[model samples]
Target: MSPLRLVIRLTAVAAVAVLVAACGGAQDPDVARVATGLLDAVDSGDGAGACALLAPPVRTELEDTSGSPCAEAVLEEDVGAPSDTTEVEVFDTMARAVVGSETLFLSRFDGRWLVVAAACDPVAGKPYDCAVGMP
Candidate 1:
């Protein structure tokens, strides 16, 4: 095949792959569940439960920054108790959940969803400012 035709075919395949991945993410209920579960745990003061829902890196970051275990350190953060999850959008292994006024980012690991970032607020023309993890 000509180089131009090969490039076009590859581009089309990539687009289709992205669309399929996005659709699959949208339909995954576990993403929403994990996001809300974290919020619920926080609201109920279940530090251990909340920490369990966090991604390993995020948990490590919290523990390292606070010089405490994740269970204790997670509770100390200003992660708000958002009563309702308004929206959840997943893209492949990554996810974004909007719970009340706060935004959370998550990732899927071993078929389990885990929160990678929480207490995020959007900054115009910039990445989110998160109370925990990357934006």
Candidate 2:
């Protein structure tokens, strides 16, 4: 191929790569950070802090089910304390994070990531079963 043609082709390839990378082609640091932060808060027994990390609906659900405020109800759940994040998958505003043996779901709201579900376990041929959030 001519030198100019080769240059144009290379530039096009580079542009495509940039686009793919920007479109969640790899694990996002922000997503992982939020997931780990939530686990850390839970592990530390920081009920109020943990509740703050939760999405609004999840917090409300916990309060309604337990008939207690979110800060107190969140502590009653059996969400595990995973030391390290194993993986994070992000799709647009939604994300799934695997931390040790637990799987948590998150959503981007108000320019921040919030935990939508936690303490989730997979069920064969069905959706995940979570201690928090919709089941």
lDDT of candidate model 2 versus the reference? 0.85
Candidate 2 structure quality by residue, lDDT tens digits, 62-121: 988999998888887778885664688888788888888889899988988899999888
Q: Tens digits of per-residue lDDT for model 1 on 3-46?
A: 99999999999999988876867767777788888888888889
Best by TM-score: 2
The alpha-carbon lDDT assigned to residue 53 of candidate 2 equals 88
lDDT of 1 at 46: 91
Error of model 1, residue 115, in angstroms: 0.4
> Candidate 2: where is the Cα deviation over 4 Å?
1-25
Which 10-residue window of candidate 2 scores lowest in summed lDDT? 21-30
Error of 1 at 76 (Å): 1.0
